[model samples]
Target: MNHGDTSRERGRRGATAHVDTFARDHLPPPDQWPGLDLDIPTPPGQPGPPGLRHPDRLNCADELLSGPPADRPVFLTPAGPAWTYGELRARVDRIAHLLTGDLGVVPGNRVLLRGPTTPWLAACWLAVLKAGAIAVTVLAQQRPHELATLCDIARVRHALCDVRAVDDLVRAEVPGLRITTYGGDAPDDLLNRPAPEGPYPAVDTAADDVALIAFTSGTTGRPKGCMHFHRDVLAIADTFSRHVLRPRPDDVFAGSPPLGFTFGLGGLVIFPLRAGASALLLEQATPRQLLPAIAEHRVSVLFTAPTAYRTMLDALDGHDVTSLRRCVSAGENLPAATWHAWHERTGLRVINGIGATELLHIFISAADEDIRPGTTGVPVPGWHARVQDEHGDPVPDGEPGLLAVRGPVGCRYLADPRQRVYVRDGWNITGDTYVREPDGYFRYVARADDMIISAGYNIAGPEVEDALLRHPDVVEAAVVGRADRARGQVVVAYAVLKEGAARDAEALRVFMKTELAPYKCPREIVFLDALPRTATGKLQRFRLRGPAYPGGDQQ
Candidate 1:
């Protein structure tokens, strides 16, 4: 289990173990990268927090999975029985052998993983890292065009896909990419291939070596590749999971996010594995499926979005959910109403967090007694956060400004010029508009781009949407600014109503006038069956501002 070499041979800035250097070559210049506060020496004579401290020559996968007791269950799924740590290690070792021996995968090569959430898919991800390759994990349901774009950006050289999900990847037709399938009887299947047995030694990658490349979910425009190092993976588990979530070894983790999403990756895989706990890997975890699974499996920790929590509340009548002790909400703002409702019903505080793909995982969050219903909690123990203006100067409390963060983990876009925009003056400006209360809690405003300016007033879309969600008949809501000739823009709302509820836009507007300022009320309401969302379930606000509106594309 030891992942250390002599400091003289492999220090933090010493030679890397990678054979291929594509990831190292593609990293943004050191000056352009956000300040990584990983190993900076503490000021003379001052004590430091015991976080992010690891050997210079380390592989996170080796550290996470190598030392657990041989017979403890690490993964549980409805499709089959639990996978003990011994079984998982055997599978990962064999896969690692196949990766290096048969697949000709060298260190630093990028390996794409496309599959539903399952033990086999998780094993592939670990094998890629154990072999010193960069993992590019993506949604299995992504279309060919999206897959092609991602492969082109990451220059993926190999892929291990579930047999059911390999067609779109083959259709992507990425040149020079080798595809290997699993979960089938084919001679070329990854797990079925021959390999040396027992334990496979882990690659001695330097702490700063790129271990994975995560892409932004394309919520704004073209997705950007984010390069994360081996240490970054463990940093999230140490800072948030250790200091905040505090999971025990016996806890059973469950969640709705896919393993490809960083939220899902942390909640379902990294956190549980690091804590020596078991996670129930679900391929399809909607509200309907999650409720029953929680009751049946005695799940202690749950992770999902605000929308899912609200949906589950409606279906909670007959389900026995006392097994859940921790519920986390992210991927979007957790409206105060939803938080209060969930807390009242389950007697568990919903930990609200705000994170970005660029930062790897949740940077700001709260748990237990530290929970604040309406605000995203203070920065995790190892991180620092503040409200700052565009000039990178701190803003006063109670004023809305950009959320600036710097910690052991920060944004490092792979060869993208937007690096200059995301990291400025050593701080990762999260592009989130937030208000810092005098008491130190960070309040969610909206995405900086989602702010609506009408005439001379500034408004946050989430504020209006939160007000609309208070209506008993409203099931879902998304607010955006539509172009208007008089005011520069007008507030417009898209809402989904309950089955038996009236769909009168005017009546809803009248109700909103009572809850929000008149200017914040929706000028026009668009009724829809469901709000538009990306494959990852993030709301697509731009679609609501299309060319149909007057000032849609403002001058």
Candidate 2:
């Protein structure tokens, strides 16, 4: 299951037996996968500089606070007062000393961090790196079993967590693990603690040395830990900051993503810290709270998902969001209507990007100067993207194919044989299906794994889901291919209606027909109380495809 094993050995050992079996029996032959040529025109310009090459040269605590205004704010929270760069650095230094001297955390040790997003949580993230230990930030919303699995997989020895979440971590029964609890706010006495003497030396880590491990859900039932290095963190900042965000050092960054999710970690911490910009930490980033915080803080840059944007737009009647200069959306596709509505209302275009846990952060994103609505835009600087056929061959232009990427960072799955299916000939095969336009922008299709073949024609699940969502009655929708003997598979829609909405199936079916092509319409509709989702807010499609649904054909 390690990186060194070959595909044949993996198959023989039954390492990924379910995945192998599904691919063998269900997927089209390699030759049948579309071949598309993607020679999209590149915008004229020299590429930006490479991301951090030397890990020692970049320290989040020092690099972010160096040469800052002595009185300027570094972090702010509702429960605690704002701290300046000088104050944050001083607190981080003391915490670093406590971790190194008292807790005995040293370079290369893995420290599991489990807590809600708070000022103390932010400081602990920085202090863990400052102490030269690898920080593994687990989602605070995760169930105990999932947390335990992650602790065991990462071989976490020491942990920093909020007191509320400690019992769950302890219940997981990770062997030989020591846990330390941190209060929600930094105490005044912490700064008086000893600073452990002279300059703290940076760990000598290469671009490939594992610095963080973020787990992502596998196509199968298990989750796979995606390993990243110190350089990858800086690489994301360098690429997205220079080419996509283009933020000034004075810009204020804020977001709703959990600190544990790489999206929030990159947007709220790494990107701003790497660029010497300040981040406002929100203990609660709900739409109600986010709008007021933006106005109160004069935040310039915002990061969130499409759902959040829609919610914010609905709640913006009395709030002043004009100070926000940029808004970035991920975690799901940005519908054209959502994009248009936001722009018509705010005069700011919502930048859309497609990033996966394996790639660390964004690799495909649209810059402000070159945004094409409804497209994922061009590859970020220092990366290359192409559409490949099932045989792993390059595809023709404007044809849907598997998106393959080669860049500063690639994926390495944790002890999973499915790594071979994802990484082929050094290119990371993002399971997304995409078409490259003549203009070089990538238009996202459905996930290859989620495509629906209905009545001898291929249908993308997201396409139908998007159409269904346009209906006023549908609040959320999930489309899956249901097995049918007559047509091989049929499109089925699972929908959650808006509050107090009628659940008349015939009326909804008629509405869908007018919105989408006849072949693309859902053959069956099932009203659901709620759709299951992971802690990170991604839909658990596999759960919908289970025996309870039984091929999706059942109403």
How high is each candidate's TM-score? 0.95, 0.86
Candidate 1 matches the true fold with a TM-score of 0.95
Model 1 has an lDDT value of 0.88
RMSD of each: 4.1, 7.7
Q: lDDT: which candidate is best?
A: 1
lDDT against the true structure, each candidate: 0.88, 0.74
Candidate 1 on 1-555: residue-level lDDT in tens? Answer: 121222321224547888898888887776676665654334345346545767789898888897779899999998788999999999999999999999999999999999999999999999999999999999987999999999999999799999999999999999999999999998878878888978999999988899999999888888999999898999998888877888999999999999889999999999999999999999999989999999999999999999999888889999999998899888999999999998888898999999889999998989998898989998877778899998888999999999998888878888899999998877899999999999999999999999999998998999999999999888799999977789988898888888889889889989999999898998888888888787778998887787643324543
lDDT string for model 2 (1-555, tens) is 112223332232212112112112322223222121112223468453543444434444445445567677767676667777777776666677887887877666778888877767777777777666778899888777888888877778889888777788888888898887776344423333445764555443433345677888434567787766555677777776666787777888898888888888889887776666778888678777899999988899998887678667667888899889989998878877678878989999999998988888887988666898879888886678889899989888899999998665667665556677777765789899999998889999988889988777989888888788778777678898878889988887899887799999899999988988899998889899787776666677777877676344354
Which run of 10 residues does model 2 get worst, by summed lDDT?
A: 14-23
Q: Which candidate wins on TM-score?
A: 1
